[model samples]
Every structure is written in structure tokens, then in C-alpha cells.
Target: MEKYWNWEGNYIGVRQKDYLTACDGIILGKFYGKEIYDQNGNYIGEIGKNNRLIKNKTKENFRRPGFSFYVKGTITAPFKSCDPYPMIPGYEDFLR
Candidate 1:
């Protein structure tokens, strides 16, 4: 359903090594000093490890050397329900 609809967004660039490291260290990095438990055996909340872990992971991702990658540019349409970009008229314009 998401692919069927047009959404305006930007791309993210990151390194492969960083990605793997982040994925492997996520659960451990999310460890807060305090832990919360629910009535059942489920876990509820943590103390102060949300934003800190995210920032650390982001830094780690950018630190990898020569790991450059880019994504497609963003396009913002005038109409919310439609994509008014690539402004018609020339068949050759569609190629881009």
C-alpha cells in the first residue's frame, strides 16, 4: 500500500560496517540503569537509555571510513494526493 501511494521523503546514507555493528549492539546499548516490569512476565520501560543509545548508534554509523552511499533525491508535489513533478509536455522528460 505504501508503494502504491506517493510519499515525499529523503534518503539516508550509511556504512555497512556501522550498520552491522549498530544492529548487533542495539539491545546491549539500550540497557538502562533501571528496568521496569509489568504484571505479567513482560518488560515495560527503562530509565534513561532511549536518546543516548540512538545518538551513539548514529555516530557509530557515520564513523566508518570510505562507506559512502546515496539515495534518490526527494520530490515535493504541489498537490497532496498527486505528484505534480516532472511537469509533463515532453516525452523525453519522463526518461529522467
Candidate 2:
């Protein structure tokens, strides 16, 4: 499971298996026949160009991206992921 960083470069969620998982290990979204669904199984988003997680513009609800234990602290990990594309605005509930 690789972590995804937000527009601010803060490590947010993760892509695990075929699901977009939160750093806390909660399943955020799932992949179904090429479409992405939220934890509640709502059609949420899709994989956009450059393999980015693009939120469904017509989605009724969304989930916020949470930080993981690996977030930059006193001692940061030597090498963490740095996603090229910042997280979508749909993940706006981040505190940091």
C-alpha cells in the first residue's frame, strides 16, 4: 500500500489492492469494473490521466483523506511517496 500526498505535500491516503484505503486501515473506496466506489459503495470517482484518483463530479458524498503514522514528524521516513498530482478537492477534510 503506497501513500498518496495531498496538494500541500502532506501524506494522506493510500492505494491498497484495488481500493483507496485510509492510512488508518479503513477501506475508503473500491474498484469495480473500472469505476471507483466509496466506503458506502457510492459511485465516487475514477482513475484519471497519469493514474490519478479523480473524484466523480456527480458524486453525492465524499470522504476526507487522513494522515498515517508515517506523516512528517520529529523524524521523517527516509523515503516516502510523493505523488505527482495533488489530491483532489474532494478530499478537503484534511486537518493538516
Which one wins on lDDT? 2
Model 2 CA deviation exceeding 4 Å by range: 1-12, 58-96
lDDT (Cα, 0-100) at 22 in candidate 1: 22
Local accuracy of candidate 2 as per-residue lDDT tens digits, 23-72: 55565566674456654556666555444455555554544343343322
Which whole-number lDDT from 0 to 100 does residue 87 have in model 2? 54
Specify the highest-TM-score model's number: 2
Candidate 1: minimum summed lDDT over ten consecutive residues — where? Answer: 1-10
Q: Model 1 over residues 1-95: C-alpha lDDT tens digits?
A: 01111111111111122121122222111112332222232232222221111122222222212222321222322212333233222211110
Global fold similarity of model 1 (TM-score): 0.17
Each prediction's TM-score versus the true structure: 0.17, 0.46
lDDT of each: 0.20, 0.50
Candidate 2: give the clashing pairs.
none
